[model samples]
Target chain A: MSPNKLLPLLVLLAVAPAWASEPAPARQKELVHLVRQDCGSCHGMTLQGGLGPSLLPADLRDKPAEGLAATIYYGRPGTPMPPWKQFMSEAEAQWIVDKLMSEFPQ
Target chain B: MKLILSLFLAALLGACATPQPLRGTGDLGLVIERATGHVTLVNTSSRQPYARIAGLGDLSHASAVYSRDGRYAFIFGRDGGLTKIDLLEGKIVKRVIQAGNAIGGSISQDGRIVVAQNYTPGGIKAFDAETLELLAEVPAEYAPGQFSKVVGLADSPGNKFVYALFDGGEIWVTDFSNPRQPTTQRYPAGKQPYDGLVTPDGRYFLAGLFGEDGVAMLDLWQPEKGARKILENYGRGEEKLPVFKMPHLRGWSVAQGKAYLPAIGRHEVLVVDVATWKEVGRIPVRGQPVFVMARPDGRQVWVNFAFPDNGKMDVIDTLAGKVVHAFEPGKGILHMEFTPRGENIWLSARDDHKVLIYDTARFTKQGEIAADSPSGIFFTARAARIGF
Candidate 1:
């Protein structure tokens, strides 16, 4: 192969390493957004449970999507948990509820 | 007309009687509650403010005990830091590190030895009262996982041994005559033994029960025998009284042959006759009544309050069994002790990080000392008596 052709190959190999180390930035952004919007004010940074129940995957893994959504919309009585019905639309609640129900303990 | 006059004279004589009812000797132990820690101290006789030294800081949640000579206060810090503070200078003269959580403790009559109980994994750590050196950590008579706190320490009379109480209701009677390898005996009571006080004569060892109302009286004088309960039915009622909470059983004062117990929930201090173990009287007090120190003369009882609220001290005329005066503290007050001369009251204002000094005679604030996390307070008199 010619020297010019070898230069192009080397450039591509160098760029590929950076690409391999890159994370799925969009997914990470979505999780952070969901936590801040849905759980941050009360349960705090990692959903380790603050004023609300611990939302760790280990704690919420067994609950169904309906129950999770209902809790988000209606809220837990006698505690600090308030109904998010006015704060979030049905679809928004469902989206975040789905995320919680899907990946928890971690 | 003569009969009427005689009746009036008799009533007047009763009112003027020297023996006050609630508690006789008003030995005030000032409690200083600080955020990082708490301390207790005795008010010195000098005009200088807050001059007494009791316990140092909130080491391991354990209480401090006065050495035999009243020269040093053996105190345990929150993280296994043991200290021997010079009562005169209020300085940590010696310190030794240990293992696990420490709570309340007791010292031997000779003041040569001190024992602090470890709350978690439950055991007793004996230390040289004067040197603050680790001597031995004796395992108390409790299960491996039992929640333990050293709550009470008392020296039985006849210069015998020192008795320390644990949360799981385990009592360790250790012979302190031998400082290094002390002999110990463990006995179970109920839930948590909050305060252990021996009679002035040292005939009986009374352990104040926190979970329940009455006391578990252990006959240390006759230990081949076991402990028994007097006033077992006390503090219980259909109305559900407020039992003394954390750092339970605040003031257990044995004077004039009576145990003055300030049961917090009931808002009343019950006087129990040690001989019969009966609830003789209930003196109504303000807030969460704790730490009833009898005046040495046995004429009045001084009561103090605890944290989260209720910061005040009340003087109860024992003969009258009524609160004569109430001192509103700017901060929460816990423990207290009278100066050696019995002229002033030193208080541990734990939350304030200051020790409050009160003129016992005038019942006025004299001065206060700034400190860090002061908790247990004590004073020494004539080197013959130790106050805790």
Candidate 2:
């Protein structure tokens, strides 16, 4: 194929996924806001962690949401992380855990 | 060599530069730079011959109980080893490691039995005070890991029964009159029964409900009826509270027919009238007060922070119903116990890795015994070993 003909195809392949995957910036702002209201009081506003482990990139930002939700539901023994199942519904923890894993400490 | 010497000198200078206050607050302020095999003591008074225990080996999380006779210090290591130290001689005379996991333990009034709570395979192992021999293993209700078993074994006011708090809100009452096969009573109460105490009257048993909201007042006198809710400190009334989210950690000071419930989340002590099951008064606290021990005189209440940095001990004059005085101990203050004479107070400084001694009368700092990595400490009036 001609070099000039290949250039257009390469550009389309490279930018298509990037543009498609990017969510509106407002959605990102809403997730950050949720974390601040839900977990910030105990974990600290910066998500640096206190009374609980840090939720930043180095700790749990990329971990599985199910595992994180399990920890929230079952709670860690001998730790302050009491099971939120009694207070929050299963779907509630999943939503917060999803937001936490994806957008926390951004 | 000279560079190393210079660095050592600089470090020493920094340690000496600060003016050592006669007394400070919390466990974090108590720093033991070196680890030792002997238990350290701080003379928090202006008296004579202040000596701290040292040289105790990597015995982190050792439960230290001072003998009632005031001559020896018994420390139970996490690995099931027990060290009997002669306080006067400042040496370990006896060391014994028996079978079982030691999660929680309390020395009896006569100091004849050391009841250690086992976690993995839930149960209580009774050991002879002097010999450290396994006397009996009292089977717990739940299986291993089912419940975070925290036992509270204290000689009843009558010295009759040794009580245990199993996981899932059950209290096991064992008649210690015969350690071989004591009459046991298993009654349901509350979740995560963390800390507990038997009232001097031996009528009602109080266990701190960590998972639930308040104190599970087990009526031993009426076991068939089970434990009644004398007070709930965690959640907002009538609503079941979730763990870690609401009022969880609570401390106890039971004496003179009153249970001083220090709810960490509420920052207050819920004084309960044992006989009537009523809320007497709310005593304010400084920070997350983890422990509330009644002074021997039964007139004052001493409270220390659970997470440190909450400077000062909450001293409550029972009659006045107000915080009379607050003394800064240090940052990592865990729990405090009084000497047999009730003149000295010993505190486990986890952050500083030292046991702090405070003068109860003067409410001033006396001296500090440097523990290499001290965790839990207690002093019993029934101790058999003493030095000097």
Candidate 3:
């Protein structure tokens, strides 16, 4: 392919899926609420840790995002953390992990 | 004209100086607004909220214990906030950040002390009910540098407190007779005792196990004997569902001759014969039960569920051994409290931001009070109960 055509193709590939990767704005709000209320039942509402570990940026920084996403999607077996796949998509779980790795929304 | 003006000023001054009515807190209660760190001081008799007091932090998993007089409420917030609120005064008397993470707490039999259960740097700390001053600290350090999260801390008879160690798998009883220098007795409990409850009679301390099939029971009358397991494998040979939220058991779970308790990872409420301490029956319900409580009359049992199923509640007919009625109050049905005589039940619909009151006998809505993400509904009558 020509250089100009390749550059345009690259931009389209990069921009299109980026929007698709994260959940939509409305669903994003629901996911945030899920993390704050439902997940907050065991993990502290402040994400400071309770029966479950903390999800604050400091606590989640060292952990792999993929592992955290898997934990959310599949749940940690033999633990109280139940699988959330029925409630959210795997991509949504990854979005939650990314938010936890940074500062979670209030 | 000057004399008339003076008289008017005198009357206005007298009205301004007059205090609130001389009343008791017998009908007063509290509604914890979890998300906003505020508590609505509600009068159960009127089914209305009189005041909304704030500043208690991170009440996500908060629970409260009443002072002996029923005038003060000691709120234990998840963010480690131990706030003592004066119900009569409609204000916070005192608050302290005594830990990094606290689960719940209980008051002594004499009502002179309030003990808080902590998860971070796990331990149970005692404070003076009057001054909120530190009285004692019993570290849940089962092993060196290893502390277990304390759960189900209940005040028993003889001015003692009993609690379960989640990580250490033990039950510990401490006598607050000498508040500053308390003595503790430990008993080896089953694996992962998630919550503990002192029987209404104050004779037994039962720890609900999460990692195993049975609950550990200790006879307070005979402390020499070790804890024994009861309700062994009630759900054995069955596939266990994921526990979206842990079940909570209080002392008042017993009704008539049976005890209605939450079944871990199961969609039923396990009924055990209190006399024999064995599973007599089970009532299948909507989802994993969180709070299984019997009305003060013991004729009916009310229950709320955990996440994904958290919006529904079941009313069990104790005599029929089955769920007589079920209803979804709203999203996030967090907690429920019945009146002293069990005539009316208050249900906290957290996500709906309302506290709905229903008449127990007719199963009809009586009132709904607006709140901000309400969770726990505590009444002053709890002050007179043994293990509130």
Candidate 4:
């Protein structure tokens, strides 16, 4: 294959893992419960605001999804937002970010 | 005509029969639902929630203290709502919003007064336990224009309330023996006392320090000596993980003449000898320990951590001074309470919306009761215990 054709194949191989790493439907449901109830302990149950800030779609609309996912993964230092990396994978954090951007599950 | 009259008489007798009353040793309790500001009345014997009462307001960090008879519960809410709940009726008897922002509260030793410690517009207010009527206000003012947030308010032995000044770094004891003119005494504790609790025997009041690396202990038997720092520099040189939430020392684990305290920003519980006020050892845990609770018999210490690892739980054998068992009961395990004799442990898994009951002896899942986003579990048996 030509070099230009090889580049497309490399890109596809690189991105394939990311797409395949999405949490299973059952796992996604559990994560949804965790964010809504566990995280909701600090952030309000509706994600409005409490000990932590509002995590609603409207409040998080301005921030980039990737940044939010990173925050969820690494956590904000010196804050009550704990690192979810121990409990979740990078892909799972992204899944939470996507859910937060839309109407998060109750 | 005779047969009709007999049926009518039977129906009248059935209608007049009164309902049977609740039995068992008043082991009933309330589980604070943080999300919706409600409490679920639970009976340990039945292992089920009988009723749920709502509208206490901002129960995110709420706590409750029982009346002497254990029939009434005084719920202190985060939004400064003090609600007096009747356990038998499963309803709020009276509620009063006395502050802008409140943390927790304490009931006097005599059970006559209830005191709430506040954050916003910082002060402590005393109210009549029966009526929820404000009796007095003691502002935590360190300077002319500065007000310190109150933390770790606990009722000591002599009808007195003791609390820590988060901003002022001081511990104050207000004797409500007089009710109106409380005799106040101040002692300098460590920096930023986050939460405090009286010992089971009500001998010492220990406060966890947030701004520093030690705990301040005040001997209630000898208040003239003032607060002394223990376990100093315990976390001085160690690199700390980012603190998600401050470890609450209110429900600290005490068993067999020792205390198992959560070390801030560390996945370890500091074991302290109560007699010597010395660090005996540190038990490594699965994550940052939130509540290190001793079993009723002092044989094991059960620990639950902060988020990410909140799903995990560790059971430490008090004698071995090590984690014997670690399990994930469910996601978001918030609070735990053991049966009076420590036969079973009731744990609130907030994410699962269930309170799991585990057999302490066999360490097996016995049963579970459905709850909302539950956080704190308080039982009527606490009414008889000191510093519950």
Candidate 5:
């Protein structure tokens, strides 16, 4: 493929990776439980922040959704944030970001 | 004179009579309702909640330490709310907001003072165990204008508070022999000491390193020697998976001369020799471990996992050095506590909102107590333990 044609595809992949797919309802419930209990271990169960940073809507309002999804999918290199790609797809991370930016489920 | 004697005897009998008979605090304990700012006082003997004390602010990751007499429980809240509640009366005696954000707390060896480790102000705050009065503040300011979150606060034998600094990568010891004029000594731990624990004898403090591949150890008997690394390069060639939850190294991790610890980013329990601080063996489990706690008698070590594996719990037989029993107790098992003599073990299943009681010897379900998003299960038995 030509460089010009590849550039737009690269942007598309960067925004939403090729391996993107919305999780099913049952999977979504598991994801919610995972975020609440597992992620809550570092971030407070209230998402008010602990050893890790807060995940409340206000704390995440300023951050970009795609970048947040990337952080969840690939993990922050230096920090304690570990990659979730082993557990969920990149699109599911974006979905989590959207939920965290709004009101997360119980 | 006979009429006066009869009246005095009746008065004495009336003063001693009450509806709800007296009970000792020995069988009492508290369960933290993580979502709600409340705690339920339960009787381990009957497996029933005697009282549910409300109005504690933000107990997301709460922990409690008992007074030497086991009368009052000092609750260290996540929002830095230090509360002293009477186990016998089942009432909040005194409460104080000490800091912005607190991780946990420890009671001094003398039990006269309680100390909290804060993440917001990044320091340790000492309080009077009785009145909840702020006694002293030790800021974890490794450098000017920079504060680091404090973790793993435990009371030592010599009226000392020992803890780890996550951002500063240092372990600190604060001697409260002179509460007003306390002296502190700092030792450089590894990259990130997530949490800490002192040995049962209160001789050594070990910090779990998150940034590196080792555990940091400091001998309280020899503070001048500084902190040293143990189990270095345990995950050298192995690619570490995502550590959904950090491994916790609290009390009762050591049993039968071996220290059982949760390995970070790996589904294994690292066993270490307390005498030499060396990696003795690794017991592979279902997932990354959150709490590797030993029963009171040190015969079996119980471990719970993080995330997907959180529902499973495995018991390690100290004699065999292997997980002899594995079972799915419930969903979201957060914390576990054993009765004073290791007769029964209580586990808090956050998702199910129930505290499941199991007979340690047979691993059979004894009873379950319904709670609101329960997490930590602490018993008055912890009062006798050096680190809780």
Candidate 6:
């Protein structure tokens, strides 16, 4: 194929992975509720901290989003945090991390 | 003038009439609102919240035991605050901070002593049920100044309390026969006894082990025999997943001659023959089971999950030994309580901020009560049961 024809194909491939990484709007809503309520059970309802550590944006500012996502996906061993891979995918975990880093849902 | 005087007298009589108070009949209960650090007094008969009593501190992992009269509830909070609330008046009668951190507690069979299992100071404290006065303190000391957190504290037969030492890997039985100076007997349980519960008949006290694949069962009748491992290697040979939340053995169900228990780090319920203490069957569920409870009739066993799958619940047929039905009553379903006759089942959906009551026979939503992040549901009917 010519250079011009290959350019469009490369662009499409690059955008496809990004599109797949984003969870659907409905799925995002469910993830938000899960983090707010389920995770909120240990980490306070205000994300301030309770039996578990604080999950507020300020406390998590120094933590990278990728590390946070991995923690959510695979869970931290020896801690109360359990693996959520059974319920969500890695991409979805990344999305949750991004939301947590930003303004988390109420 | 005569007609006006008669109307005034009738109005005076109407104003003098006071509302009737709730009498103890094993129909009342409390829903622990974890986030708000309060409990909502609920009338299971009317399926309505009568009152919300606050001031209990750090209820993130709170549990309650009712008085033998079923009129008072002794709530154990995570912050080590033990509050005794009068169910009739819906008020805290006595509150005391007995430790630095605590998980749960139990009442003695004689109804004279209440014990709080601690995580901070690492010991068990016995208090007078009526006065909330500290009667005894037994530190769970394993090494020099090293105390193990206590778990699975349950009232056994003969006014004794049985509990597991999380760090010590031992089960201790404290006889409160004297109340003031209790005698304790310790037995080696498996590694990491996370939680435990006594059977409905108070014959067996089973503790769920987190560091291993099986559970430790203690025969209360034969205390000399010590704790034995039951359902050993139930999670053997499989790549175990991280346990998000520890399976609450308090909700372990016994029905139709079998005990339904949530297998740690697995999406299955292990059904053990209560008579044989052997695994008889395993039922696959949606996710990690949290609360595996049985109806009062022992015909159906209901199971709830942890974290991401906490929204859904499954019903297992005890006779058939299979999951017959699965439904999502609401988000963040925390606890379940069956009515005295098994006519209705009440579930707390913390995310939805409501408690959904279902008709047991048809499994239909009967009613819903507004609550504030409720987690645990306790009914007066539990006061009559063996291990509340």
Clashes of each: 65, 48, 0, 1, 0, 1
Stretches of model 4 off by over 4 angstroms after superposition: A1-106, B1-25
In model 2, the Cα lDDT at residue B18 comes to 50
Top TM-score hit: 3
lDDT, candidate 2, B1-388, per-residue tens: 4465346435543544354555321111112222234444333334221334444443433456545655555665444556676545445667776533443356665667666665434667777778777778776755554644445655553334444454556777776667666567777777766656666655667776766676777776677888766676544664332323222222244567776776735567778787687888888787656567777776788887533233457888887887898877765565676765567777766445456777777887767654433445544342432110
Worst 10 residues of 1 chain B by lDDT: B23-32
Worst 10 residues of 3 chain B by lDDT: B8-17
lDDT of each: 0.57, 0.56, 0.87, 0.83, 0.87, 0.83
Tens-digit per-residue lDDT, A1-106, candidate 2? 9998886456445545333444457755654543542343235335544324556645774677577878777776655565656544555556556545544434
Q: Per-residue lDDT for B1-388 in model 3, tens only?
A: 4465346434433543345588988899999989889888888888877777879998999999998889999999998999999887778989999999999999988889999999997989999999999999999999899999999899899989999999999999999899999999999998888888999888999999998888999999998998999998877768788888888887456789899889998898898999999888889999999999999889999989988889998999998889999988799999999988889999999888889999999999999977778899999999998777
Off by over 4 Å in 2: A1-106, B1-37, B41-61, B66-72, B108-111, B143-148, B157-161, B221-225, B238-252, B255-257, B308-312, B339-362, B367-388
Of the two candidates 1 and 4, the one with more favorable DockQ, higher being better, is: 4
Which prediction has the highest DockQ against the true structure?
Answer: 3
Indicate which candidate wins on lDDT. Answer: 3
Q: Give the DockQ (2 decimals) of all models.
A: 0.03, 0.11, 0.58, 0.16, 0.50, 0.17
Better of 3 and 5 by lDDT: 3
Question: How would the candidate models be sorted by TM-score, starting from the highest?
Answer: 3, 5, 6, 4, 1, 2
How big is the positional error of residue B138 in model 2, measured in Å on the Cα after superposition?
1.7
Report residue B47 deviation for candidate 3 (angstroms): 1.0
Chain A TM-score vs. truth, each candidate: 0.58, 0.54, 0.80, 0.78, 0.79, 0.77
Off by over 4 Å in 5: A1-31, A102-106, B1-19
Model 1 alpha-carbon miss at residue A21, Å: 40
- lDDT: the better of candidates 3 and 4: 3
What is the Å distance of residue A77 in model 3 from its true position? 1.8
